[model samples]
Target: MKLPDPPLNQASEIAGDWPLHGLAEDMRPALAQALARGAAGLATIISLGEGGPRPVGAQMVFGMESRAGFLSGGCIEADVEAHARACMADGRPRRLVYGEGSPWPDIRLLCGARIEILVERLASDDDAARALLALAEAREPAAWISDGERRLCAPASDPAPTWPGAFSRRFDPPPRLVVFGGDPTALAVASLGAQSGFSTTLVRPKGPIAPPPLAGVAYRRDDVAGAVAAVGLDAWTAVAVCGHDEEVDHEALLAALPSAASYVGLLGARRRLGARLDRLRAAGVAETDLQKLRAPIGLDLGGKAPFEVAVAIIGEIMASRHGQPALARRPVSTPDGDGQAAKPPGGGKS
Candidate 1:
């Protein structure tokens, strides 16, 4: 797409509440909205040194009247926006440096790290922007390439960087959570997941006709298997089973265990894990898949409140998504038959 010559009138800056480290897909929606407002610019971190607050490929969209996303932890955004406005005005690409060897030495990063950001004026009909927004809406992976001026996008085959000097990024669909439960803990998890930028869906069999008061979470009143099928599990999806009903939990586990979901968690007493595993094994679940289950469902944060448990659960999911190693914990024995274990005191349900 060709750049528009001559900048439009400077519109009043309207602040935006966007995530600091939002995903590539997350930036697309705001970017589209910003483009719709006339003149807009895209600022991206093309390089980073040690101790940088955000990673490479982090982006911020600046419009004539609005801005979204963030480049730092509130240290250099104002300066970045200034440079972005200048680039928009000149219709030229600029490479900005900060922390070290920066033209503006006054703006220092608290982390004492250096970063290189590419700022360029982007047209509303830019091919890269349109492709990215369309792919994000369709929940498809895409590869983006830009050299501060020209931009290109295509369906992603291998999501790895290719071009040398230009910015290359692979955009994946946002993480998703399919939670099966309607209790307070379940509601808290679904709500927190949605707030945390996840595509969240809460499935409660025979639930109330009216949906819960949560804002971003989608409600499903179907059975576990049906809900799983309808929602469609993916490698970027997570499943949390916390119905507290034995049969319901078991059914949910059965449906989730053998799926493409990256994380599958079950909420229950640690002692009862063996019985659940045994049942799952007898039901023909592969041993490898059974090993993927995270029983007791969360990091051992020792908080019993519903929101606290939700925090632990979301923390664990984030850890998994970032490829963090699982914490060491005692293993459950593989005793045969449906052995019963005494449920412990209220710790957000057994």
Candidate 2:
């Protein structure tokens, strides 16, 4: 009942290995694709000790001739793949230990961390995979539970599994970005956001007849409220108002602040933020919501250039998402021997 290995010549044609530091959502599509090949297996890091590069829930999908996702930063993927192939051959689940106490003493991890992986053959009509993909498409949270053989996918709020030796993980929707602007800064933010793996959209009111020339970015010309309604803000969404127009920026902020977006930022001078906040208050935006606004948007990276600002903006958003504190009052060295304190942009593009 063993599955045959691919022909030797096909080795060069088979492609595999993608960096593993991304949302599980990124790995699920590859898993689905592998399933379509009729023979697929999954490898998951079920346990991890200190100093491991990837977290316990990291996963990789294997097809007959290809594989995707990373596990040990390239230290153990080939061996893991070999184990997955063996599991697929016998249709049996396997638990592999590497690093300390590993049966394969020669397979040492550079980080010197011990880890355990579970390899299992996945049926083409796997219900858990289907449910997980569906939930991801709907931008909802899902919980995946597995016992090395059986698997289940349910809403994140579902009760904990009582099954013995089961491993469970919760997956939240991927981060999304909605940029309200049509300027260079806006384009840069949208472009960088898309490249950085956010489901990115650029909303411009009465913008050019043609969309901005950026790949992987959805362009919307609707008014701020209409754009917000269409985008459907969620807890994982980030809104940036950088139109540089007083009225338009206010409109975007006014619409975005009341939504469920996890981050709301406005690009302007810190001094002008008071006036903007006053206008928003006059328009009935609650103080609690206003407090969430990141005025002079970005991490105070002391850059005035469009791309620089975009980096700071995206960095700040990611930091907020990851619960990291934003960098503050950093000092930048000027051409003169003296160092000048870097400050967030007061006005104008860098």
Candidate 3:
């Protein structure tokens, strides 16, 4: 269904910071409020060039005078908000480009990159917004297509429109991190995961030891296998087993290995990893599948504290998610044909 432009006069300026916490799930409350007030507008990043601050499909929900998320760095939000107001006034979608050679010569993006934003006015009961929310809840990836006269959501596999000026943007579910175990380390990792924009969940088996309180993280009390299934691990999900219990770690690994999870990490020393692998193989997990597991999970950041380890783990997960090499190093050969390090990865002395 096509959404009509909202009345520009209906908005009133409100004072507060943008409520964004870096996840689409965090925008639900603002979206619902804007829709209920009949002042909702959708702003999305349709295209982003090299070095762009935000990736394509990043979006925000705007009310007449309030915003709930961010589209770019501080450089472009004001202009995008102004265009959104215009879209509401005219019942039409507006496309805005910012960055190098932009019409506003005075405004320069810090990264000197280009981005395209599409703003569309939405009504209180907009079907398109509802559809997008449904897909998000289901954790399904889909394409949002608009051709001026109509707006619709389709499967991710749908072909893009060939018509001139038509736009299609794909939206995927937010990345999820499921941490198994209720130890202090697990709590720290879960906290870091949430702060880093992942939908974080802490799962631990029911026992006499109570789980620690973790703010902004969902808590689950179930066996490892059940918890894995409950979280609905997808290709965007990362599972980390942090408990010291071998049985718990083994069960979590078994459950996660068969899934399409982008990362499966086990927290322990190198020695424990070998024993765990042996158990997993004895339990019928294939050797090739075991290769996907990251034992002694986390980058070698040389920090032994719980928080430092958590940072390393989250860093590795982010690197894996973005397809970046976890370690940055230049290899050098010694006279004996053995490898010698010139400099440590991520800028450090050898």
Which is the leading candidate under TM-score?
2
User: Tens digit of lDDT per residue, candidate 1, span 186-273?
Assistant: 9999999998888899999889989999988999998887888888888889999978788888888888889889999888766577
Q: Can you give the lDDT of residue 134 in candidate 2?
A: 85
Better of 1 and 2 by TM-score: 2
Q: How accurate is candidate 1 locally (lDDT)?
A: 0.78
**In model 3, which runs have C-alpha deviations exceeding 4 angstroms?**
1-33, 47-50, 104-114, 147-149, 159-162, 207-211, 326-350
Question: Least lDDT summed over 10 consecutive residues: which range in candidate 2?
Answer: 4-13
Show pairs that collide, candidate 3. Answer: none
Global lDDT of model 3: 0.70
Residue 58 accuracy (lDDT) in model 2: 88
Model 1: which residue pairs collide? 268-350
- Residue 215 of model 3: what lDDT? 69
Model 1 residue runs over 4 Å out of place are 1-25, 36-39, 158-164, 326-350
Report how far residue 59 has shifted in candidate 3, in Å: 2.5
TM-score of each: 0.84, 0.85, 0.80
lDDT of 1 at 190: 96
For model 1, what is the alpha-carbon lDDT of residue 197?
A: 82
